[model samples]
Target chain A: MSTSRSSASSKSGARQSKVTVNSQWKAYLQHHRVTAKDSLIRLLKSPGSSIMTWLVLGIALSLPMTLFVSLENVKQLSRVWDQSSQISVYLKKGVVPRLAQGLSDEIQALPQVTSAYYISPELALKEFSAATGLSDVVEGLESNPLPGVISVVPSLASQDAKAMEKLQDQLMHFVQVESVQLDLLWVKRLYQFMELGQRMVWALALLLGLAVLLIIGNTIRLSIENRRDEILVVKLVGGTDAFVRRPFLYTGIWFGLGGGLIAWFLLSLGLYWLSGPVEQLIGLYGSEFVLSGLGVKDSLLLICDGVVLGWLGAWLAVSRHLARINP
Target chain B: MAHVRFDNVSKSYPGGHHALSGVNFEINQGEIAFLTGHSGAGKSTLLKLIMLMEKATQGQVLVDGVNLSRLGNSQIPYHRRRVGVVFQNHQLLFDRSVFENVALPLRISGYSSRDLERRVRAALDKVGLLKKEKQSPIELSGGEQQRIGIARAVVNKPSLILADEPTGNLDPTLSAEIMRLFEQFNDVGVSVLIASHDLPLIDRLDHRVIGLKDGRLLNERPAGGL
Candidate 1:
């Protein structure tokens, strides 16, 4: 009976301590909410200069972001160029049109050729004359100088430079063929330039990311200076560094979110302004191409970049300056 | 029992400017004492040692029998929670209201909203400022601000109250009233230590007075020891 009684009393004591610990955690969470709201409100109360900060951050973030979007568009254009890669196989001078037609069928049956069409010399001459607005000049010629040609669209896998070159060599070896020309090398060069553009975008994004961090750091440094006396008072009254730091960190978050929102606005405006004209131009080419804006993934990544930079800047500022102010 | 003991503690800055040298004193539980000295006589240093704001260069400083030197950085806040401090400047956060100023310590100690309100109200009532809860610190007179600082200090019901020249900016009537407030706290088992240079006023009270001169203790009297 005595042991049971003592155990009951100890349990009550343990329960009391547990209640206090729970309250401690709940109160800390409460303070976190209050400070977060307080900081956001504080920023809102002083929006003139902070709006300027957000504007500057937005412009800096949107520049590299716009460049990246443009690079992606160029990449997409190169992909369209990749689709039209074809090889032209010209017949020898004395080769008959029937022989050229048979050769075209044979080339179409090859693994690398998706499709091939035979064009007689008369038809080729007519197409050239019509394309150049020189029908009278072409009709006055004594004989058709164009060769019978087999136009072969390569399979998707054979569109690359090395594969197309090999395919051209194989076609040139045909008995009736005089020459083979692949229309893909220019697209390959364009793709290389697109890759270089992507690299430049990444480099510019990195430099601008540093710029965002410096802006946040300088802003936070000013915040710390403005609250110097308040910090000293807090230090005197038993406030922990974390307790003091919570609000400033919240301020940094507000700045980041505000900047992110502004950047999103700017990017959307630019895309909206360009999408109509771009679609009209694409329509004029008789092709169906749709302009895409910032998708979900890219938008989230941009906001994440802003938040991470904001946090890094605030952490740097608080650690450097808070220690100098003693009670 | 001795609640605070400074065992020959000495403190010096990096430039070898000695703030406190070989000081020893103690304040027992349920006692009130005055620490009087000139401007540079180490009163603030002694208080800083209790708050663990600065470490002693040599010897030991103890609060409620715990060696302060052994108190790690993580434990410093909890240590401070148990010691009330009222500064001479009455460092009330002017950005907040009087109620918020008094509620700071309770908020730090993790009091629930109900408990925080009750304790803050009780503290303000102790200083007869419960009606002025909604006013700003700037809206109040100097004496009122000082009382607000005291309310903040005692709101947590700390075992020890350390006042650093708390009445230095107050008039004579206001100073005595502040002393009475400290006396009331001491009457209820809380130990109070006030640092002041008002020698004439301190002599009028029966509380013990510890005197420091040139970073050294001249007298170390206990409560009721005259």
Candidate 2:
């Protein structure tokens, strides 16, 4: 009975302390909320300085984002051309129609070659005469001079430059083939242009990311100087470094968030402004395509990037500057 | 048991300047004492040791039977919360009202909103500035600002109060009133230590006094004027 009573009292004591600690955490969170709000209000009290910071950050963030969007649009346009890769195989002179048809069958049998069509010399000459309207000149000739042709389409997977070049070389070595023309140089050029654009965008993003860090770091340093006296008083009153750092960090977050919103607004406005002209151009070409702006995912990513960079800059400043202050 | 005990305590600054050496004294619980000395006589350093502001270089400082030397950086704030401190400059934030200034310590100590209001009001009442809660400290007189600093120090119900020249800027009449307030707290079982060079004023009060000169302790008085 004595042990039971002691254990019961000890349990109650433990519970009481637990309750106190929980309340302490709650109170800390409450203070954090207040500090966040107060810091934002402090920023708002000086609107001119704060707006300049946001505008600088917004311009930095929007440049790379605009490049990325344009790169996406170009890629969308090139996708249609990727699907229509064709190769023209011209027959050697003195090749018979049956030999040409047989060679076309052999070309189509290759795994990388999707399909091949045979064009006899008779039909080729007749079509040429009709197209050129030169039947009198053709009738004056004694023998037909047109070569048999095989039109080949490569598989989607083998539509790259290296693969097409290799296939063309192999066809040139064929006994019945005289020349092979793979018109994929335009596709190759477009791909190179897209690659260069992507690399440039990444470089700009990195350079501008550093710019953002410097901006936030400088702002926080000034803020620390402005509140030097207040910081000393807080420290003298038993406030820990973490406690004193809470408000400045919140200020940095607000700045980053505001910059992100500005960038998003500017991006959407630019896209809206361009959409009308782009739609008319698309209609002039009788295209059914629509201009797609940044989706929900990209916008969220942009904002998250701003927030992280802002946080990192503020953390760097606080850790460096706050420790130097002594009460 | 003594509320504060210094056992051969010594302090030296970074440049080998000896601030205090071989200082020894003890103030029992519920006692009021004055630390008097000339400028740069280690009076401030001695009080700072008790508050754990400056670590002792040679010996131990025991406050409420806890060795101050054992405290780490994380523990310093908690240690300070138990000891109230009033400054001569009354470093109150001008942006806040008088009530907010006094309520700061309590808020930092994690008091709930409901308890915070009552405790802040009670502290203001004790300082006899209950009517000026909403007024800014800038509008108040010098003595009132000093009292607001005192209220902020004591709002957490600390068992020890350390005042470093708390009334240095106030007149003799106001200084006496501040001393009476410290005495009231001492009567209620709080140890109060005041460091000041105001010999004429401190000598008029009936309390134990410790004197220091050039980093050495002179002697300790039991219960009398210096």
Candidate 3:
């Protein structure tokens, strides 16, 4: 009986503390909601300065985001061209068309080669005449000077310079082949250039990210100075450091969120403005490539970046300055 | 038990300026006392020690059986909540209304909305400014502003109230009225300490007096025997 009574009372005590914890949690959330709303309202009250800060943050956020997205698109375009790394095998002038077709069949069966198509001397002459508009001059020759060619396209996995060189050496050993041609230097150089561009973009992003941090930090510091009296009074009245910091942290979030949205809008506007001209330029090159803007995933990431930077900047400013403003 | 206790407490500034040295006093729970000293005589520093606003260079200060020196930074806010404070200059935020000013302490303490509203109104009513709740404190007279400050201090219903020259600018009549207000709170079992230089006014109160001069304790007088 005694053991049961003690257990019952201890359970009751546990429940009592649980109720208090629940209420305290509720109160904590309530304060956060109030502080967040109050900070947003304060920002809205001062429209001119708030808008300027948002604009400045937006421009800063957009510079790197713009470069990143543009590089992504350019990388996609180069990837398409890179996959087309092909080798043209020219047969001797006197080689028979049947032997050339046999050679093309054998090349197509190679592991690295994707597809091989044989172009007869007759078809080659016709294509050259059509391309250069030199049919009568080419027909004026005693016989067709153009050689039979086999164009070998490598698989996507084997598009690198070393793999192309290996394939070229194999093709040169073909009995009917005269010369093997592969433009290897430009392909290697383009790969290196694209990698450098990507690294440069990332470096720029880091520098600009630091700039954003300093901007937000300075802005919050000025705000802390402006409200020096309020902070002192709050501290005097028993406000905790966390309580005093809630509103400023919320303010930083607002700036970050607003700035992120503006950057997204600017990127979309810029992409839209450039898309038409970009399409026309690509069309002139007889290729159809569309310029893409920030997708949903990237846009969300940009906004999250702004918010994180804003939070970190505010935290830095608050921790450094609030300590000095003792009651 | 004493609501506030200082045992050989000493405080010194960075440049070796001792704000308080070898100060000792105890205000038992439910007692009202006045701390009298000239300007720069360590009255403020003694009160600051109680509030944990300034740490003592040596010795201990206790409030409600808890050593203040042992309290960490995070515990200071809870300690201040238990001890209400009224400043000399009526540290009221001019941008807010009278109601909001009194509600500041309760809000800081995270009172529910219903409790906050009812308690704020009660505090304002106690100070006789219930009807002026919506008006900005800047629009009120000096005495009214000070009353608002007092209302704010007591809004959270702290066990102890510390006033630093709360009536420094008020005339004799207003000052006596403020003393009566503190007495009323004392009558309800709240320990009160007022730091002031108004000797005549302090004499009229007939409360216990703890005197200090040049960072040293002078003497103590029992109530009704000053």
Candidate 4:
């Protein structure tokens, strides 16, 4: 009976301590909420300054993010083009249609060639005449001068750019072919340019990110000076540096977050604004490709980046200035 | 009990302006003491040293047995939790209500909401400004603002309270009322040390008084007995 009574009392004490801890946490959160509310209210009160700061940050942040998204879009386009890279070989005149077909079948049997197509000289001449708007000129000719071309398309499943080039060169040695043309130069250069552009975008983004930090730091310094008296009061009232810095940190976060949202909006706006013109241009070229905006994953990353930058800027400002303003 | 001890403490600014020179004094527990001095006599510096706002260039400052000079950065907040301070300018947060100002210390010390509300109300009631709890400090008179400062200082039930010219901006009557409030807190076992140069006001309070001249303690007297 005595043991049971002691155990019961101990359990009650434990329960009491747990309740106390829970209550303490609730109170802590309540205080933080009050502080956060006051901070937001203060920011709202000075809407002009807040807006100005946020705009500066947003513009700064948006430049890199927009560039990054554009670069990503470019990357996607390049990826599609890179995968579509294939060599098209056209044969000379007087190659028999049946011989061209046999050559195509042989090329298709090769491991390097994914597929090959045999176009008879008659069909080739007809297609050329239609494409160039020179059907009357071809009609007056005595014979179809166009070649019985065997087009070779290589597979990208293997990693062999040099091997593919060599294979294209070796196809020129065929007895039935007079000349071979491989149109891979422009595609290779285009891929290289896209990669270079991505690197440049990253470098520029990093440099501008540092500039944003400095801007935020200086702004926070001015804010600290403006609110020197308030800070002194807080310090005198036994507020820790962390407690004193909470609001400024929130301000910085808000700046970053707001700036990020603005940047996202601006990027989307730019993409939306450009889409119609780009689609019309593509239609003129008889292409069905549509320009795409930032994808879901990328948009999320941009928002996270904005918030982090704002947080980092605020942290930098507070650490540098709070040390100088003692109670 | 809140007592402050300065042992061979000295403070010199970076530009070689010596604010305090080997200052040594002991304020006993529950004693209401006046740190009286002329302008730039290091009265402010002394209070700052005790509050651990400024580190001593030499020697140590101990408050309630904690050596502030040796305290770590993280531990500074814990040290401050034991002391309540009021500034010369009242330095009340103008953005907050009087009740919220009083609740600042309690909030920092992590007091529960129910306890914070109760204690803040009690502090405002003690300062005779309970009705003005919802009023902003900026909306109040100078004396009322100083009282709010006082309420903030004492709300946490700290063992020691330091006021640096808390009434410098107030009239004589208001100054006396502020001193009375400090005395009332002192009577209840909270040590009070106020830095002021108002001779007449200092003469009226029956408490210990320490005088500083040129960063050195010149004399000390027992309130009206001086």
Structure candidate 2, residue pairs in collision? none
DockQ (CA atoms), all models? 0.25, 0.24, 0.21, 0.21
Which segments of candidate 1 are over 4 A away from where they belong?
Answer: A1-19, A87-181
lDDT of 3: 0.86
Q: Kindly list the per-residue Cα lDDT of model 1 for residues A1-327, writing each as its tens digit.
A: 112222333232232212288888999999999998998898889989899998888888888889888877766665566677778888889888778888889999999989999999999998999899999999899999998888999888777677888898899899999888876668668767877888898999899888888898899999999999888766766778898888888888878888877888899899999999999998887766677788999898777777777777788888888888776
lDDT of 3 by residue, A1-327 (tens): 112222333232232112245555676788899889988999999999999999999999999999899888887776678766778899998898888888899999999989999999899999999999998998899988888999989988788677778888988887788999987889878777878888988998899888888888898999999889989999888999998998899988888899899999999999999999998987787665678788899999999999998888898899989899998
Expressed as tens digits, the lDDT of each residue in A274-299 for candidate 4 is 98987898678565566878888878
TM-score, chain B, each candidate: 0.97, 0.97, 0.98, 0.96
Candidate 3 lDDT tens digits, B4-116: 88999999999999989898888877778899999999999888888888999999998878999899999998888878899899999998899999988777777777767
User: lDDT by residue for model 4 over B113-225, one digit each (tens)?
Assistant: 77778889988999999999998989999898888888888787776789999889888888889888987776666667899989898887656789998888888887557
Q: Which residue pairs in candidate 4 have backbone atoms (N, alpha carbon, C) closer than 3 angstroms, thus clashing?
A: none
Best by the DockQ measure: 1
Query: Which candidate's TM-score is highest?
Result: 3
Which docking class does model 4 fall in?
incorrect
The true-versus-predicted C-alpha distance at residue A272 of model 2, in Å, is: 1.8
Question: Candidate 2 vs candidate 3: which has greater TM-score?
Answer: 3
Q: By how many angstroms RMSD does model 4 differ from the true structure?
A: 7.3
Tens-digit lDDT string for candidate 1 (B127-202): 9999999999999999999999999998887768899988888899999999899988776667778999998789
